[model samples]
Target: MSTVHIVGAGIAGLAAATWLLAAGRRVAIHESAGHAGGRCRSFFDETLDRTIDNGNHLLLSGNVAMMDYLRRIGAEDQLTGPSRAAFPFVDLSDGSRWTVEPNAGPIPWWILLSGRRIPGTSVFDHFSALNLATANADATVVEAVGGEGPLFRRFWEPLAVAVLNTPAETGAATLLWRVVRETFGRGATACLPLIAREGLSQTFIEPALTYLEANGAKIAFNRRLRAIEREGDAVTALDFGDVDVSLDSTDSIILAVPPAAATSLLPGIEAPLESHAIVNAHFRLEGAPAAVIGGMPFLGLVGGVAQWLFVRGDIVSITVSAADALAEESTERIAELTWADVAVALDLPASPIPPCRVVKERRATFAQTPAAEMRRPGPRSPLGNLFLAGDWTNTGLPATIEGAIRSGEAAACAVAT
Candidate 1:
């Protein structure tokens, strides 16, 4: 059997390896980094004396690809969140708090309920998002939603920025619409929030690596592909820094690196160039406050620097999506601003900030604009045996875990034939 060479052992590469391995194809994974889980891993923070994920990755029940991937690796139960589709939010502008809870059915009558909707939003305002579904290529979330009114400030704006990781003014409306169609449109059963109970590596990355290795797949760490040599319409060889690997006609190669790395390997690739940052402030606290609701442990915020706050035991983590400007600020300033939001949302006193670890993922995700989204290429390249896989690829979705997994599966399907 011809071995399938998978490059860049991130989630995309790992996912592709698993799919091919299940189909009885010989597999070999080569990673440039010394360790696995490129961006979605946990590390022990000495400052906080705890293990913290590099960034916050919240999953919804409607994320079918991620759920299927988790189940395949036998780690589906590793994630946990609130039992119901509930997202509690606080408006720092007016000191108003409310929980947006979706009902069991598709008809969103919950928005008509006073307490279930955003503080000042009406049912018509919630349903106004229907414009997003038919948004054209040039339409952004702002254009679709009008970028004003009570719903925009309280609900659409926050949800758009959080899920798209790009400002609503520039974020593609279709992408956000797809997310809403899958999650919110499907009702509460599909919109329940979820996150790794232990850590991301324990839930998503480590298990996939283990499953691939236990299935007799070969994995090589610290093996970076310096160049890929193509002859005519086929990729002939891959050159590592110290070693060169020649590919047989039957053998296939999957390049699952990031867009920047992939551009260097394959010349003139159509990949998303613009990227945004995601900033996280992980703070160590003594214990949970008395205001904790059913131990849900996370909250959404409006008119604040911190977009979302997540709590796990004694650690409280704050997430700011599309935070390119904030990422450039000093750590102390970021902590100070984030803690202010956390304090108000969690109902804690405005005490001095605790020991904090600020993490800035500069190239966390691609800027999901219509122009950038159009630049995303499919898995197949000019070289028949060489396939491309990444969240940045044309997966008909934003650069998300679900898109990454789907891209890998698409690459596997290409090589499987």
Candidate 2:
């Protein structure tokens, strides 16, 4: 069996290795970081005396690839879901709430019937989104939903951020359309939203590693590939600092690091997209609400200090999606603004604000601008036995775990074939 060298032990790399190993290929994963789960890590906050994730991530029934990956790794049971076909939404401004039922299986019938919970939304909203199904493939989401009203702004804009990690104005319309069609428009089973009952590392990454190890896959921590040596069409070896690991001429390699690192390793590779930031604020509060926020685990904050709040026991975390605007702001300032938003949205009066942890990942995601769309590369590269895997690649979706998993699967399949 041919050996496969996977660079970066992120979710994508892990997924690829898992697949390749299952195919009876010898696999070795080299990671620069000492720990696994690159962006999806968690740590015990001693002050709070609880394990906290680096950030909050949600999975939708529409994310089939992710769900399948989870089940394969034996962590699918770690996810908790609300009753199928129901999503709750709360308006922090007025404390008014609504639930968007999943409707019937796969196809989103509720979208056509439920307008009261989704403020400013109407039956036309479904029609408008459906129209996008036939829109020009090259058009931006903003162009596809031209003049569709605040419903587009309220529901679509946040949805785009949650899906693509980019704003609707710059996000890919075709991707959004596909996401909606597959998850919301296809059937009711695709609409269930699953939240990680435990930390992401425990629920997804760790289980994946265990599965890989059980199958004889090796993961090398602190072994970063500084460069790739190629002979004509094939890669001969990878250069990690202080070591030169030779590879079989037929061995396959998957570069699953960030775009910045990819550009450096593959000098000729072009990444047209610039990186963006996401700011997440975690607060340790007393007496936090246990009831699921509206049926959805998360709520969109409009015209307020909190953009979106996720309630996890004593820890109340707020995520500011696509938060490039706050990149230059001080941590204190960002936390202050975010807490104020949470206060208003959660309707808390005079509650003591516990010590807050503000995480600002300046390069959390790639900027999904129009030009960036053109820069996204596919699984196959110019070099043979060398492929790319990451959410940043041309997975059609935004920089998400689902996209990462899909890209990894594609890369692994490419190598196997």
TM-score of each: 0.98, 0.93
Tens digit of lDDT per residue, candidate 1, span 1-417? 898999988888888999898889999989999888888889999999999999988989998989888989899999999888888888888888788888999888887787677777777886677788889988999999898988999888999999889999999999998888889899999999999999999998889988987999999999999998878888888899798989888889999999999998888888888899999999999875554455676888889999988888889999999999999999999999999888888777677898999999999999999999889999998788999999999988788888899999999999997
Q: What is the C-alpha lDDT of each candidate?
A: 0.89, 0.79
Local lDDT at 163 for model 1: 87
Candidate number achieving the greatest lDDT relative to the actual structure: 1
The best candidate by TM-score is: 1
lDDT of 2 at 89: 56
lDDT of 2: 0.79
Weakest 10 consecutive residues, lDDT, candidate 1? 288-297
lDDT of 2 by residue, 24-121 (tens): 88998899999889887788877678888888887787888888888888888988877665655556666666666666666556666656437667
Error of 1 at 265 (Å): 1.1
Q: Could you tell me how far off, in angstroms, the CA of residue 319 lies in candidate 1 after the best superposition?
A: 0.4
